[model samples]
Target: MTEPRTFTLRDDLKLALELADAADAISRARFTALDLVVTTKPDRTPVTDADQAVERAIRTVLAEQRPGDGILGEEFGTAGSTSRQWIIDPIDGTAGFMRGIPIWATLIALAVDGVPVVGVVSAPALGKRWWASAGAGAWSSDERTPNASPTRLAVSGVDTLAEASISYGSLQQWDQAGHLDEIVSLSRQVWRTRAYGDMWSYMLLAEGHLDMAGEFDLQPYDMAALAPIVQEAGGVFTSIDGKPGPWHGSALATNGLLHDATLAVLNPA
Candidate 1:
């Protein structure tokens, strides 16, 4: 197998777009097949299928195009090296999806020596895909607008917590993590709040439509794809405790201006 090309960010960005196409195919199909009739709580089969299928598709492509590269997937586990690993989460908001909500998507990212350098979020049901490569601008496409160029994205300038809008992934996640009060406190201090519960929240922030995004109990795949997009869009991406990377098990993403203030509020004594 040939070594993976250490392409420029432009090439990486193009690959991210191709990966989004593959992910959308598997994800949208399963999403459409889901019954979405929350009888009791929610089901996981639809997400499991979508997740595995999407990861398999990505793996197949990487094997052919970047043979020496590694992969870490939510459904398939790890394979190959970590030097140029591809991380994937084929379906990020299974619960919302199972309940007939449109907040789910597939997250694809390339982490070089554990630092995510390229990221893509494809939510077909929502008709949007967002992506970014290190040093490249963040971008998004709307399937609703056929053939239109993807718009460059940027974070908002709401500098104060009182003026910022925020979305934490899930109330249940915070409650389970014993940080519900901290989350609630932060929400009250912020101008707006919503548990958009997945990729949608972060994408909204990257588009300058929201000011803050944070969550707990996340894996690397959940946060990796988000980091580059948020960073490229002029936002800060870090752990809730103010750590600078996605390995910290929690996340706090905000337009660069409001990051520190949001960190102060999210940190529990």
Candidate 2:
């Protein structure tokens, strides 16, 4: 089979789902294995055997299915053409994953030029998967309804911060990013808050369970898959300073209605 120089949004999305399946097979088996190898990357973040294997598996699949596309993976770094790149986080919440927590997932995204056009977040431990393409809308399925048609996702209608339920990855993230006082003030204004951390927070927002979710110190692999799901679900994804796309160092996602307000609270100037 010949590889096309470009793929349609639907085709890219289909391939992403296939890559997720390849990833889940490896990750699920190593989730809590007694001998799961653990090591640190140059930046001091944890990398487990599952993370390495999942990324390698997905890369292998992409090589077979989309040979011409580029790849930006957490474990393997970058390769190939930038025009049609695949961004992947083999396991988004590695720390929690290594500890037997079920918050980790394989995040796959297809970016055309620099914009994400397809995304798939698959969490096998939680038995849930969410996906979206540029115009196909966001959808999800859980263990209970895995074979059933996915439930379409839509952002909640909570327009006011006073009534909004918010999730910031962690208080320490804000503090470490030199915005501790800002988060403290924002937390006081929200109706409720929790630290849902990683891809789950944005997924919850996309599914209409939360109004806003933001975090600091993120890489492109961490936010690329998430931005499209939130956008297709009728939400907004931007940098903490309101820039577009996932290249920025931080992420601020909200139900469309509350985006401007949330941005104001985070950036007072």
Candidate 3:
């Protein structure tokens, strides 16, 4: 494969940031306008609109800025063919968004030859955004202090499962995967557990506030932007079964020290 030099890492990061801005506008408006009354379960129409709008906005920008680069979006599907591809999840936690929870975000990543080198997660409702490049340190900005310098992120140092915290995206996901028992058993072994769900789970893990996060039934867009940030923050990014990279349908992220142990617990013989 020839080296594709369409954009610098910095340029891709900037594009990710711009897409985040567009995503925030679409997500925030639809989120705030949601009825939020869950009759039994959440409705999907609002999120559908938000998802399409955000993705369309991103595709438009990419079409102009990096026409040579390809795009694979959750809402829009795949397009173009450069080895350098943009993977996007316009809203990562549509269930949370529908429920009026502020945990969802827009995820954007630049993956070269199937490895993500740039990532951005923007959650406007939570007033937060986290980003990282292959080498740049993982950093986050709190909406509470927009003018302040971004705080660098690092994974926790907890080396033992008995002293580590974990976030599994959702119990429903585990149950659907027929791994609810495994999740329950693992939860009992961990220091603590929370189904923080979506980008927040990994963000918390990257911040050293949590140690492990895993989820199933995800697409590449959902995991691409998150892998680099977690890895750059001194964590490990792998599939639930321990394969590396974001192509897997599931993910397991942990502080580097406890990654193997967590995988062992989840993938016991």
lDDT of 2 at 38: 99
Between prediction 1 and prediction 3, the one with superior lDDT is: 3
Task: Kindly provide the TM-score of model 2 when superposed on the true structure, using C-alpha atoms.
Answer: 0.97
| Highest lDDT scorer | 2
User: Quick one: ranking by TM-score, best first?
Assistant: 2, 3, 1
lDDT against the true structure, per candidate, is: 0.84, 0.93, 0.89
Model 3, 45-157: lDDT tens digits are 34466777889999999998888989999877899887899999998987777767888999999999999999999999989999999999899999999689999999999
Question: Which residue pairs in candidate 3 have backbone atoms (N, alpha carbon, C) closer than 3 angstroms, thus clashing?
Answer: none
Q: Candidates' TM-scores?
A: 0.91, 0.97, 0.92
Q: Name the lDDT value of residue 42 in candidate 1.
A: 43
Q: Please write out the lDDT profile of model 2 over residues 1-269, one tens digit for every residue.
A: 97547667988888889889889999999999999999999999989999899998988988898888899999999999758899999999999999999998999999998999899999999999999999899999898775798999999999899999999988889999998888888999999999998999999999999999999999999999999999999999999989999999999999989999888889988
Q: Give the root-mean-square deviation of each candidate in angstroms.
A: 3.1, 1.4, 3.5
lDDT accuracy of residue 47 in candidate 3: 43
Backbone atom clashes (below 3 Å) for every candidate: 0, 0, 0
| lDDT for each residue of candidate 1 in 137-215, tens digit (9 for 90 to 100) | 8999898997899899999989888998899988888899888888889888988898777888899999998999888
Which candidate should be chosen as best, given TM-score against the real structure?
2
**Residue 92, candidate 1: C-alpha displacement in angstroms:** 1.2
Q: Model 1: how far is 47 from its true place, Å?
A: 4.3
